[model samples]
Target: MNSPADSGAHRPTPVAVVTGSDSGIGRATAVRLAADGMDIGITWHTDEDGARRTAEEVRAHGRRAAVRHMDLTELPDAADAVDRLAQELGRIDVLVNNAGTGTATPFLDMEYATVRGVLDVDLIGPFLCGQLAARRMIRQGGGGRIVNVTSVHEHQPRVGAAPYCAAKGGLGLLTQVMALELAEHGITVNAVAPGEIATPMTGQEDEDVTSTSRPGVPLGRPGDAREVASVIAFLASEDASYVTGASWVVDGGMLRMGPQAGSHLESDAWRRP
Candidate 1:
């Protein structure tokens, strides 16, 4: 009798665990991946209802969906949700570290607790979660994908966002290191850095981005969640098998405004932060 390996068994359907999938880019990415024929593991912090809604969307695509709660600020324990979702969904083939938080206080006025919370949610959370996902992928003996959702601040600085920029910048570099180290295991890591997007995080959820105005941004407005999701979907697909350690900027030319913005500013409002 032939053994299981020699029996030509079919592989299970792919599974993806997207953190903070209750809304915004996370929700859009979960739906997009489901449409790509992968089961989804959805996570939410305070928005269980929104997570259920996201799961409904995934199921609408005829893919399996599992829901969990993940509070990144909770630290090493929060990452265990990845393992639970992977087990429930049969396997973990992709991990999108989309859960994060930020602060708007100036550097001098920022509290230790606030800075720590931002770092925990944005940087350390992804770090621990990536470790868990990568271990599972290595054990499964196949390739995997990890997409870290950073910000345009990952490349530039925002006046009011000190800890936020630091966390994102650190995550951007961490993606590269993970890509380099995990290449041997066939796990590609990448960062999706978005500029100003119309998400609840930015107080623009459900807003019509086309109608918004932003003189500093080359696109003249904010980006839709789906726009960012499309790029993330590409990075999570086989088409990006050869691509890794790259930060795909979906910012609508916001980062390119360094010189122009410096010259066009009319007041000291930029320094008030």
Candidate 2:
């Protein structure tokens, strides 16, 4: 927890706060950033052990790692973890709003609480955390990076994920607005839209993405977590300094298959939840 301010002669290292680092894309992003020479602030909601494992990976890269519990469903309060991480890690150079939740229930059957919960975690939570990180970056007088993890659903819709799509779509636009407003401060904001990655959320944890067949997808397989992480890492790096207000799609041509998929569908199976 020692900050550079605590040691007069020590220089501050870049630090990144990645929410939901318990596993999957978040974990991969945390480790990737660490490999790029950044201290990491790792957060989890239900999987503390997984978060600890991610922290170990960061430490393995010879970087400091701070662990915190972040329940995005708790709203504005949960965002306080961002500030706490920034404080513990000295400063926040990057913030990856990777923590998110989704639902597969049909829209007509969805409950108000379920819809609200999805919005809270996938949208409002990142909104608050982004504010916290941006303010800290402004106060610290340096440019920063903010990467919101959206899904391909952010740009397209599915049969059963009504609230999930709504939240992610809203987040996609939010990222653009944030980028526009934070530009003067030299802070860049962007969104990474992933599709069918081999993550726990998709029920394919630790599976070899290449072995998994995704017939509808042009790549013929789901993407690897590391593939998504690599794009995020680039966005968080100086190479992306000129890039902001953009949604980088890392779906291995999935998004491009929309027309092809629609034309080839033979039954009403595509309409079911």
Which candidate should be chosen as best, given lDDT against the real structure? 2
| Candidate 1 per-residue lDDT over residues 157-200, each given as its tens digit | 88879999999999999999999999999999999998889999
Give the alpha carbon lDDT tens digit for every residue of 4-29 in model 2.
Answer: 23323565788999999999999999
lDDT of each: 0.89, 0.90
RMSD of each: 5.3, 4.9
Q: State in Å the error of residue 182, model 1.
A: 0.3
- Residue 50 lDDT in candidate 1: 99
C-alpha TM-score for every candidate: 0.92, 0.92
Clash pairs, model 2 backbone: none
